[model samples]
Target: MQTPSAADLLLAWERGLDQSPTRRALSLLEACLPGVTLDRLAALPIGMRDTQLLRLRESLFGNSVAAVSECPDCGERLDVAFNTNDVRHMSVEKIDAETMEPQTQAHQLHTGGYDITYRIPTSSDLLVISTADDIEPQLALLQRCLTEVQQNGIPVQANALPDSVIAAISKDMANADPQAQIELGLVCPECSYAWNALFDIAAFLWNEIHAWAKRMLHEVHTLARTYGWREADILAMSARRRQIYLELAQT
Candidate 1:
Protein backbone atom coordinates (compact mmCIF):
# COMPACT_ATOMS: atom_id res chain seq x y z
CA MET A 1 0.00 0.00 0.00
CA GLN A 2 1.12 3.52 -0.80
CA THR A 3 1.36 6.39 1.64
CA PRO A 4 -2.09 7.81 2.30
CA SER A 5 -3.01 11.28 1.08
CA ALA A 6 -3.64 14.06 3.58
CA ALA A 7 -7.35 14.13 2.77
CA ASP A 8 -7.69 10.41 3.33
CA LEU A 9 -5.71 10.53 6.55
CA LEU A 10 -7.77 13.44 7.88
CA LEU A 11 -10.97 11.54 7.23
CA ALA A 12 -9.53 8.47 8.92
CA TRP A 13 -8.55 10.47 11.98
CA GLU A 14 -12.02 12.00 12.20
CA ARG A 15 -13.73 8.63 11.93
CA GLY A 16 -11.38 6.97 14.45
CA LEU A 17 -11.86 9.54 17.24
CA ASP A 18 -14.46 7.31 18.92
CA GLN A 19 -13.18 3.86 17.93
CA SER A 20 -10.96 1.47 19.85
CA PRO A 21 -7.24 1.39 19.13
CA THR A 22 -7.56 -1.90 17.25
CA ARG A 23 -10.42 -0.62 15.11
CA ARG A 24 -8.62 2.67 14.55
CA ALA A 25 -5.52 0.88 13.32
CA LEU A 26 -7.55 -1.24 10.95
CA SER A 27 -9.36 1.82 9.65
CA LEU A 28 -6.11 3.65 9.05
CA LEU A 29 -4.77 0.67 7.15
CA GLU A 30 -7.95 0.48 5.10
CA ALA A 31 -7.66 4.16 4.20
CA CYS A 32 -4.09 3.75 2.98
CA LEU A 33 -4.40 0.29 1.46
CA PRO A 34 -6.89 0.84 -1.35
CA GLY A 35 -8.48 -2.28 -2.86
CA VAL A 36 -7.71 -4.21 0.34
CA THR A 37 -10.64 -5.45 2.39
CA LEU A 38 -11.19 -4.79 6.10
CA ASP A 39 -11.29 -8.57 6.57
CA ARG A 40 -7.73 -8.77 5.26
CA LEU A 41 -6.57 -6.03 7.61
CA ALA A 42 -8.27 -7.76 10.53
CA ALA A 43 -6.58 -11.02 9.53
CA LEU A 44 -3.09 -9.52 9.69
CA PRO A 45 -0.96 -10.79 12.56
CA ILE A 46 -0.41 -8.12 15.22
CA GLY A 47 3.32 -7.93 14.58
CA MET A 48 2.88 -7.63 10.84
CA ARG A 49 0.11 -5.08 11.34
CA ASP A 50 2.30 -2.97 13.59
CA THR A 51 5.21 -3.34 11.18
CA GLN A 52 3.13 -1.89 8.37
CA LEU A 53 1.97 0.97 10.64
CA LEU A 54 5.59 1.69 11.56
CA ARG A 55 6.50 1.93 7.90
CA LEU A 56 3.61 4.30 7.26
CA ARG A 57 4.59 6.39 10.28
CA GLU A 58 8.19 6.68 9.13
CA SER A 59 7.03 7.70 5.70
CA LEU A 60 4.57 10.32 6.98
CA PHE A 61 6.51 11.75 9.88
CA GLY A 62 10.16 10.69 10.23
CA ASN A 63 12.45 7.89 11.30
CA SER A 64 12.56 8.89 14.96
CA VAL A 65 9.93 7.80 17.50
CA ALA A 66 9.80 9.87 20.66
CA ALA A 67 8.12 8.75 23.88
CA VAL A 68 7.83 10.01 27.44
CA SER A 69 7.99 7.72 30.46
CA GLU A 70 7.95 8.47 34.14
CA CYS A 71 10.60 7.12 36.46
CA PRO A 72 9.10 4.75 38.97
CA ASP A 73 11.35 5.71 41.84
CA CYS A 74 11.38 9.52 41.53
CA GLY A 75 8.42 10.35 39.30
CA GLU A 76 10.78 12.04 36.90
CA ARG A 77 9.76 12.07 33.28
CA LEU A 78 12.23 10.87 30.67
CA ASP A 79 12.26 11.41 26.96
CA VAL A 80 13.06 8.29 25.05
CA ALA A 81 13.95 8.52 21.39
CA PHE A 82 14.63 5.69 18.98
CA ASN A 83 14.67 5.09 15.27
CA THR A 84 11.74 3.20 13.74
CA ASN A 85 14.06 0.55 12.35
CA ASP A 86 15.51 -0.21 15.78
CA VAL A 87 12.38 -1.81 17.27
CA ARG A 88 11.33 -3.55 14.05
CA HIS A 89 11.51 -7.31 14.34
CA MET A 90 14.19 -8.93 12.21
CA SER A 91 11.83 -11.51 10.73
CA VAL A 92 11.09 -10.82 7.08
CA GLU A 93 7.42 -11.27 6.19
CA LYS A 94 6.96 -12.25 2.59
CA ILE A 95 4.24 -10.58 0.52
CA ASP A 96 1.23 -12.49 -0.71
CA ALA A 97 0.66 -12.16 -4.47
CA GLU A 98 -3.10 -12.47 -4.32
CA THR A 99 -3.80 -9.83 -1.66
CA MET A 100 -0.62 -7.80 -2.07
CA GLU A 101 -0.15 -8.07 1.71
CA PRO A 102 2.23 -9.94 3.94
CA GLN A 103 1.51 -13.61 4.50
CA THR A 104 2.15 -15.21 7.89
CA GLN A 105 2.78 -18.89 8.60
CA ALA A 106 1.57 -21.00 11.49
CA HIS A 107 4.09 -21.80 14.25
CA GLN A 108 4.50 -25.09 16.06
CA LEU A 109 5.67 -25.68 19.63
CA HIS A 110 6.43 -28.69 21.83
CA THR A 111 6.60 -28.08 25.56
CA GLY A 112 5.50 -29.68 28.81
CA GLY A 113 4.51 -32.94 27.12
CA TYR A 114 2.24 -31.06 24.75
CA ASP A 115 2.37 -30.39 21.01
CA ILE A 116 0.55 -27.45 19.41
CA THR A 117 0.25 -25.68 16.10
CA TYR A 118 -0.89 -22.08 16.31
CA ARG A 119 -1.04 -18.92 14.26
CA ILE A 120 -0.21 -15.50 15.61
CA PRO A 121 -3.02 -13.39 17.09
CA THR A 122 -4.75 -11.08 14.63
CA SER A 123 -6.68 -7.82 15.12
CA SER A 124 -9.95 -9.66 14.67
CA ASP A 125 -8.99 -12.10 17.36
CA LEU A 126 -8.23 -9.27 19.76
CA LEU A 127 -11.46 -7.44 18.92
CA VAL A 128 -13.59 -10.52 19.44
CA ILE A 129 -11.96 -11.42 22.73
CA SER A 130 -12.08 -7.87 24.06
CA THR A 131 -15.89 -7.72 23.95
CA ALA A 132 -16.53 -11.17 25.38
CA ASP A 133 -17.50 -11.34 29.10
CA ASP A 134 -15.82 -13.30 31.89
CA ILE A 135 -12.81 -14.28 29.82
CA GLU A 136 -9.07 -13.71 30.28
CA PRO A 137 -7.89 -11.75 27.27
CA GLN A 138 -4.52 -13.47 27.11
CA LEU A 139 -6.02 -16.90 27.47
CA ALA A 140 -8.71 -16.09 24.96
CA LEU A 141 -6.11 -14.92 22.47
CA LEU A 142 -4.14 -18.14 23.01
CA GLN A 143 -7.24 -20.23 22.47
CA ARG A 144 -8.13 -18.36 19.28
CA CYS A 145 -4.68 -18.71 17.76
CA LEU A 146 -4.20 -22.38 18.53
CA THR A 147 -5.21 -24.29 15.43
CA GLU A 148 -4.41 -27.71 16.83
CA VAL A 149 -3.39 -29.08 20.22
CA GLN A 150 -2.20 -32.53 21.18
CA GLN A 151 -0.94 -33.96 24.46
CA ASN A 152 0.98 -37.27 24.52
CA GLY A 153 -0.47 -38.03 21.08
CA ILE A 154 -3.99 -37.27 22.40
CA PRO A 155 -5.91 -34.20 21.27
CA VAL A 156 -6.91 -31.64 23.89
CA GLN A 157 -8.44 -28.20 24.28
CA ALA A 158 -6.27 -25.12 24.84
CA ASN A 159 -8.02 -24.23 28.10
CA ALA A 160 -7.12 -27.64 29.49
CA LEU A 161 -3.41 -26.73 29.34
CA PRO A 162 -1.65 -26.04 32.65
CA ASP A 163 -0.26 -22.65 33.63
CA SER A 164 3.36 -23.66 33.03
CA VAL A 165 2.49 -25.06 29.64
CA ILE A 166 0.48 -21.98 28.76
CA ALA A 167 3.30 -19.72 29.90
CA ALA A 168 5.74 -21.64 27.73
CA ILE A 169 3.45 -21.28 24.75
CA SER A 170 3.11 -17.54 25.42
CA LYS A 171 6.89 -17.20 25.61
CA ASP A 172 7.28 -19.06 22.34
CA MET A 173 4.68 -16.86 20.73
CA ALA A 174 6.48 -13.71 21.93
CA ASN A 175 9.78 -15.00 20.59
CA ALA A 176 8.25 -15.84 17.23
CA ASP A 177 6.53 -12.45 16.97
CA PRO A 178 8.79 -9.99 18.71
CA GLN A 179 7.15 -6.92 17.22
CA ALA A 180 3.89 -7.77 18.94
CA GLN A 181 5.49 -7.20 22.34
CA ILE A 182 7.99 -4.33 22.22
CA GLU A 183 9.59 -3.58 25.57
CA LEU A 184 11.96 -0.65 25.79
CA GLY A 185 14.72 -1.06 28.35
CA LEU A 186 14.84 2.26 30.17
CA VAL A 187 17.00 3.56 33.02
CA CYS A 188 15.95 6.65 34.86
CA PRO A 189 18.72 9.24 35.08
CA GLU A 190 17.43 10.65 38.35
CA CYS A 191 16.88 7.44 40.32
CA SER A 192 18.67 4.85 38.16
CA TYR A 193 15.68 2.50 38.31
CA ALA A 194 15.76 0.30 35.25
CA TRP A 195 12.53 -0.91 33.69
CA ASN A 196 10.90 -1.97 30.47
CA ALA A 197 8.19 -0.05 28.67
CA LEU A 198 5.79 -1.07 25.92
CA PHE A 199 5.77 1.08 22.81
CA ASP A 200 2.56 0.52 20.90
CA ILE A 201 2.94 1.72 17.30
CA ALA A 202 -0.78 1.79 16.57
CA ALA A 203 -1.52 4.22 19.39
CA PHE A 204 1.61 6.24 18.73
CA LEU A 205 0.90 6.61 15.03
CA TRP A 206 -2.75 7.42 15.65
CA ASN A 207 -1.77 10.17 18.09
CA GLU A 208 0.55 11.67 15.53
CA ILE A 209 -2.10 11.49 12.84
CA HIS A 210 -4.64 13.07 15.17
CA ALA A 211 -2.32 15.93 15.98
CA TRP A 212 -1.49 16.50 12.32
CA ALA A 213 -5.14 16.49 11.36
CA LYS A 214 -5.95 19.05 14.04
CA ARG A 215 -3.16 21.35 12.89
CA MET A 216 -4.27 20.98 9.28
CA LEU A 217 -7.83 21.90 10.19
CA HIS A 218 -6.60 25.08 11.82
CA GLU A 219 -4.51 25.92 8.80
CA VAL A 220 -7.41 25.22 6.51
CA HIS A 221 -9.66 27.47 8.55
CA THR A 222 -7.10 30.26 8.49
CA LEU A 223 -6.58 30.07 4.73
CA ALA A 224 -10.29 29.87 4.11
CA ARG A 225 -10.99 32.88 6.28
CA THR A 226 -8.24 34.96 4.68
CA TYR A 227 -8.37 33.88 1.01
CA GLY A 228 -11.77 32.12 0.81
CA TRP A 229 -10.31 28.89 -0.56
CA ARG A 230 -12.33 25.68 -0.25
CA GLU A 231 -11.36 23.03 2.33
CA ALA A 232 -10.87 20.43 -0.36
CA ASP A 233 -8.79 22.82 -2.41
CA ILE A 234 -6.53 23.59 0.52
CA LEU A 235 -6.04 19.94 1.44
CA ALA A 236 -5.45 19.00 -2.18
CA MET A 237 -2.52 21.37 -2.35
CA SER A 238 0.96 20.08 -1.49
CA ALA A 239 2.03 20.34 2.15
CA ARG A 240 4.79 22.76 1.23
CA ARG A 241 2.38 24.90 -0.79
CA ARG A 242 -0.21 24.89 1.96
CA GLN A 243 2.37 25.94 4.55
CA ILE A 244 3.48 28.79 2.33
CA TYR A 245 -0.06 30.01 1.97
CA LEU A 246 -0.69 29.64 5.69
CA GLU A 247 2.31 31.83 6.38
CA LEU A 248 1.13 34.45 3.93
CA ALA A 249 -2.38 34.34 5.35
CA GLN A 250 -1.15 34.74 8.90
CA THR A 251 1.13 37.63 7.93
Candidate 2:
Protein backbone atom coordinates (compact mmCIF):
# COMPACT_ATOMS: atom_id res chain seq x y z
CA MET A 1 0.00 0.00 0.00
CA GLN A 2 1.23 3.52 -0.77
CA THR A 3 2.11 5.41 2.37
CA PRO A 4 0.03 8.52 2.89
CA SER A 5 1.94 11.75 2.42
CA ALA A 6 2.89 14.22 5.16
CA ALA A 7 0.62 16.72 3.48
CA ASP A 8 -2.16 14.20 3.92
CA LEU A 9 -1.38 13.89 7.59
CA LEU A 10 -1.28 17.66 8.00
CA LEU A 11 -4.56 18.04 6.24
CA ALA A 12 -6.05 15.46 8.53
CA TRP A 13 -4.74 17.32 11.56
CA GLU A 14 -6.24 20.55 10.32
CA ARG A 15 -9.61 18.93 9.80
CA GLY A 16 -9.62 17.74 13.38
CA LEU A 17 -10.12 21.23 14.88
CA ASP A 18 -13.89 20.79 14.97
CA GLN A 19 -13.48 17.48 16.76
CA SER A 20 -12.37 16.76 20.32
CA PRO A 21 -8.59 16.44 20.75
CA THR A 22 -8.87 12.74 21.42
CA ARG A 23 -11.24 12.32 18.52
CA ARG A 24 -9.09 14.53 16.35
CA ALA A 25 -5.96 12.62 17.29
CA LEU A 26 -7.78 9.39 16.67
CA SER A 27 -8.93 10.67 13.31
CA LEU A 28 -5.40 11.74 12.41
CA LEU A 29 -4.25 8.20 13.11
CA GLU A 30 -7.03 6.72 11.02
CA ALA A 31 -6.23 8.97 8.11
CA CYS A 32 -2.67 7.68 8.06
CA LEU A 33 -3.59 4.11 8.82
CA PRO A 34 -1.30 1.30 7.58
CA GLY A 35 1.50 3.84 7.35
CA VAL A 36 1.53 6.35 10.19
CA THR A 37 -1.30 7.27 12.50
CA LEU A 38 -1.59 10.01 15.09
CA ASP A 39 -1.50 7.32 17.78
CA ARG A 40 1.88 6.02 16.56
CA LEU A 41 3.22 9.56 16.17
CA ALA A 42 2.50 10.25 19.82
CA ALA A 43 5.34 9.41 22.21
CA LEU A 44 3.07 9.26 25.26
CA PRO A 45 -0.11 7.50 26.05
CA ILE A 46 -3.08 9.90 26.47
CA GLY A 47 -0.74 12.38 24.85
CA MET A 48 -1.67 16.03 24.64
CA ARG A 49 -1.92 17.37 21.10
CA ASP A 50 0.74 19.94 21.91
CA THR A 51 3.15 17.15 22.78
CA GLN A 52 2.36 15.44 19.51
CA LEU A 53 2.90 18.71 17.65
CA LEU A 54 6.27 19.05 19.39
CA ARG A 55 7.21 15.66 18.01
CA LEU A 56 6.17 16.77 14.53
CA ARG A 57 8.18 19.97 14.87
CA GLU A 58 11.35 18.12 15.86
CA SER A 59 10.87 15.64 13.05
CA LEU A 60 10.72 18.53 10.58
CA PHE A 61 13.12 21.01 12.18
CA GLY A 62 16.44 20.57 13.94
CA ASN A 63 16.30 20.37 17.76
CA SER A 64 16.94 23.86 19.09
CA VAL A 65 14.02 26.27 18.97
CA ALA A 66 14.66 29.94 19.55
CA ALA A 67 12.51 30.62 22.61
CA VAL A 68 11.91 34.13 23.91
CA SER A 69 10.44 34.99 27.27
CA GLU A 70 9.76 38.04 29.45
CA CYS A 71 9.94 37.63 33.20
CA PRO A 72 6.75 38.91 34.77
CA ASP A 73 8.48 39.36 38.13
CA CYS A 74 11.57 41.36 37.21
CA GLY A 75 10.47 42.66 33.83
CA GLU A 76 13.70 41.15 32.58
CA ARG A 77 14.01 40.10 28.98
CA LEU A 78 15.07 36.50 28.63
CA ASP A 79 16.09 34.85 25.41
CA VAL A 80 17.17 31.24 25.38
CA ALA A 81 17.36 28.23 23.19
CA PHE A 82 14.69 25.58 23.65
CA ASN A 83 15.53 22.04 22.61
CA THR A 84 12.73 20.58 20.51
CA ASN A 85 14.45 17.20 20.41
CA ASP A 86 14.41 16.94 24.19
CA VAL A 87 10.77 17.90 24.20
CA ARG A 88 9.97 15.39 21.48
CA HIS A 89 11.99 12.54 22.92
CA MET A 90 10.69 12.94 26.46
CA SER A 91 9.47 9.61 27.82
CA VAL A 92 5.75 9.14 28.33
CA GLU A 93 3.65 6.18 29.29
CA LYS A 94 0.12 5.42 28.22
CA ILE A 95 -2.49 5.88 30.96
CA ASP A 96 -3.27 2.31 31.82
CA ALA A 97 -6.86 1.22 31.21
CA GLU A 98 -7.07 0.06 34.80
CA THR A 99 -6.15 3.50 36.05
CA MET A 100 -8.58 5.27 33.72
CA GLU A 101 -11.39 2.89 34.65
CA PRO A 102 -10.96 3.79 38.32
CA GLN A 103 -11.27 7.45 37.55
CA THR A 104 -14.62 6.71 35.98
CA GLN A 105 -15.58 4.66 38.97
CA ALA A 106 -14.54 7.47 41.29
CA HIS A 107 -16.72 9.87 39.36
CA GLN A 108 -19.57 7.50 39.97
CA LEU A 109 -18.86 7.05 43.67
CA HIS A 110 -18.71 10.80 44.46
CA THR A 111 -17.23 9.76 47.81
CA GLY A 112 -14.28 12.06 47.49
CA GLY A 113 -14.55 15.79 48.08
CA TYR A 114 -15.61 18.14 45.28
CA ASP A 115 -12.20 17.63 43.77
CA ILE A 116 -12.66 13.91 43.25
CA THR A 117 -16.07 13.98 41.58
CA TYR A 118 -15.14 15.50 38.23
CA ARG A 119 -13.82 13.53 35.27
CA ILE A 120 -10.71 14.47 33.33
CA PRO A 121 -11.54 17.29 30.95
CA THR A 122 -11.51 15.81 27.48
CA SER A 123 -11.37 17.52 24.06
CA SER A 124 -15.14 17.36 23.91
CA ASP A 125 -15.40 19.10 27.29
CA LEU A 126 -13.14 21.92 26.14
CA LEU A 127 -15.39 22.59 23.16
CA VAL A 128 -18.32 23.14 25.46
CA ILE A 129 -16.24 25.40 27.67
CA SER A 130 -15.16 27.56 24.73
CA THR A 131 -18.75 28.36 23.78
CA ALA A 132 -19.71 29.52 27.24
CA ASP A 133 -20.34 33.28 27.59
CA ASP A 134 -18.15 33.75 30.65
CA ILE A 135 -15.87 31.94 33.06
CA GLU A 136 -18.72 31.17 35.44
CA PRO A 137 -20.86 29.75 32.69
CA GLN A 138 -17.93 27.89 31.23
CA LEU A 139 -17.08 26.36 34.59
CA ALA A 140 -20.73 25.56 35.05
CA LEU A 141 -20.86 23.83 31.67
CA LEU A 142 -17.72 21.87 32.39
CA GLN A 143 -19.23 20.67 35.64
CA ARG A 144 -22.49 19.85 33.93
CA CYS A 145 -20.68 17.69 31.43
CA LEU A 146 -18.52 15.99 34.04
CA THR A 147 -20.83 15.56 37.01
CA GLU A 148 -22.08 11.97 37.08
CA VAL A 149 -24.01 12.20 40.32
CA GLN A 150 -25.41 14.86 42.62
CA GLN A 151 -24.35 15.31 46.25
CA ASN A 152 -27.71 13.88 47.24
CA GLY A 153 -26.62 10.54 45.75
CA ILE A 154 -28.93 10.92 42.80
CA PRO A 155 -27.77 10.73 39.18
CA VAL A 156 -28.04 14.29 37.82
CA GLN A 157 -29.90 14.89 34.60
CA ALA A 158 -27.43 16.74 32.42
CA ASN A 159 -29.78 19.22 30.77
CA ALA A 160 -31.89 19.89 33.83
CA LEU A 161 -29.02 20.44 36.26
CA PRO A 162 -28.83 23.78 38.15
CA ASP A 163 -25.94 26.19 37.55
CA SER A 164 -24.96 26.10 41.23
CA VAL A 165 -24.76 22.33 41.15
CA ILE A 166 -22.70 22.52 37.98
CA ALA A 167 -20.28 24.92 39.64
CA ALA A 168 -19.82 22.58 42.54
CA ILE A 169 -19.29 19.68 40.15
CA SER A 170 -16.60 21.58 38.26
CA LYS A 171 -14.75 22.24 41.50
CA ASP A 172 -14.96 18.58 42.41
CA MET A 173 -13.63 17.44 39.05
CA ALA A 174 -10.74 19.88 39.31
CA ASN A 175 -9.70 18.37 42.62
CA ALA A 176 -9.75 14.85 41.23
CA ASP A 177 -7.04 15.32 38.61
CA PRO A 178 -3.75 16.71 39.86
CA GLN A 179 -2.24 16.47 36.40
CA ALA A 180 -4.90 18.85 35.18
CA GLN A 181 -4.32 21.23 38.03
CA ILE A 182 -2.90 24.64 37.14
CA GLU A 183 -0.72 26.33 39.73
CA LEU A 184 1.90 29.07 39.95
CA GLY A 185 5.54 27.88 39.92
CA LEU A 186 7.87 30.74 39.06
CA VAL A 187 10.46 32.50 41.17
CA CYS A 188 12.12 35.55 39.69
CA PRO A 189 15.89 35.32 39.74
CA GLU A 190 16.50 39.07 39.91
CA CYS A 191 13.73 40.65 42.01
CA SER A 192 12.64 37.40 43.64
CA TYR A 193 9.18 38.06 42.30
CA ALA A 194 6.80 35.16 42.54
CA TRP A 195 3.74 34.59 40.40
CA ASN A 196 1.32 31.86 39.57
CA ALA A 197 1.73 30.12 36.25
CA LEU A 198 -1.35 28.45 34.90
CA PHE A 199 -0.60 25.24 33.07
CA ASP A 200 -3.49 24.99 30.67
CA ILE A 201 -3.78 22.31 28.01
CA ALA A 202 -5.73 24.49 25.57
CA ALA A 203 -3.15 27.24 25.57
CA PHE A 204 -0.33 24.72 25.28
CA LEU A 205 -1.97 23.06 22.29
CA TRP A 206 -2.39 26.39 20.51
CA ASN A 207 1.26 27.28 20.86
CA GLU A 208 2.34 23.82 19.73
CA ILE A 209 0.22 23.97 16.59
CA HIS A 210 1.63 27.41 15.80
CA ALA A 211 5.20 26.15 16.11
CA TRP A 212 4.59 22.96 14.14
CA ALA A 213 2.94 24.81 11.29
CA LYS A 214 5.94 27.11 10.97
CA ARG A 215 8.45 24.24 11.06
CA MET A 216 6.58 22.24 8.45
CA LEU A 217 6.61 25.23 6.12
CA HIS A 218 10.35 25.51 6.58
CA GLU A 219 10.80 21.84 5.66
CA VAL A 220 8.68 22.36 2.57
CA HIS A 221 10.95 25.17 1.48
CA THR A 222 14.17 23.25 2.09
CA LEU A 223 13.11 20.05 0.37
CA ALA A 224 11.58 21.87 -2.56
CA ARG A 225 14.81 23.78 -3.13
CA THR A 226 17.19 20.83 -2.70
CA TYR A 227 15.26 18.36 -4.85
CA GLY A 228 13.48 20.75 -7.26
CA TRP A 229 10.27 19.14 -6.07
CA ARG A 230 6.83 20.58 -5.41
CA GLU A 231 5.62 21.05 -1.84
CA ALA A 232 3.47 17.97 -2.20
CA ASP A 233 6.38 15.88 -3.48
CA ILE A 234 8.71 17.03 -0.73
CA LEU A 235 6.13 16.36 1.94
CA ALA A 236 5.66 12.89 0.47
CA MET A 237 9.31 11.99 1.13
CA SER A 238 9.81 9.84 4.20
CA ALA A 239 11.89 11.42 6.95
CA ARG A 240 14.64 8.78 6.49
CA ARG A 241 14.92 9.26 2.72
CA ARG A 242 14.79 13.02 3.11
CA GLN A 243 17.72 12.96 5.54
CA ILE A 244 19.65 10.62 3.24
CA TYR A 245 19.12 12.97 0.31
CA LEU A 246 20.21 15.93 2.41
CA GLU A 247 23.40 14.03 3.33
CA LEU A 248 24.10 13.10 -0.25
CA ALA A 249 23.55 16.68 -1.38
CA GLN A 250 26.07 17.92 1.19
CA THR A 251 28.61 15.41 -0.10
Clashes of each: 0, 8
Best by lDDT: 1
lDDT, each prediction: 0.88, 0.50
Flag clash pairs in model 2. 29-38, 114-172, 115-172, 115-175, 115-176, 118-173, 184-196, 184-197
Candidate 1 residue-pair clash tally: 0
| Candidate 2 residue spans exceeding 4 A from truth | 1-5, 16-70, 77-103, 108-118, 132-135, 146-171, 182-184, 225-227, 238-251
TM-score of each: 0.94, 0.53
Highest TM-score among the candidates is held by which one? 1
lDDT (Cα, tens digit) per residue for candidate 2, span 12-81: 6577667655455545444434354333333222333334444344544445665444578568755445
Give per-residue CA lDDT, model 1, range 138-167, as digits (tens): 889888999999988899998899999999
Cα deviation of 11, candidate 1, in Å: 0.9
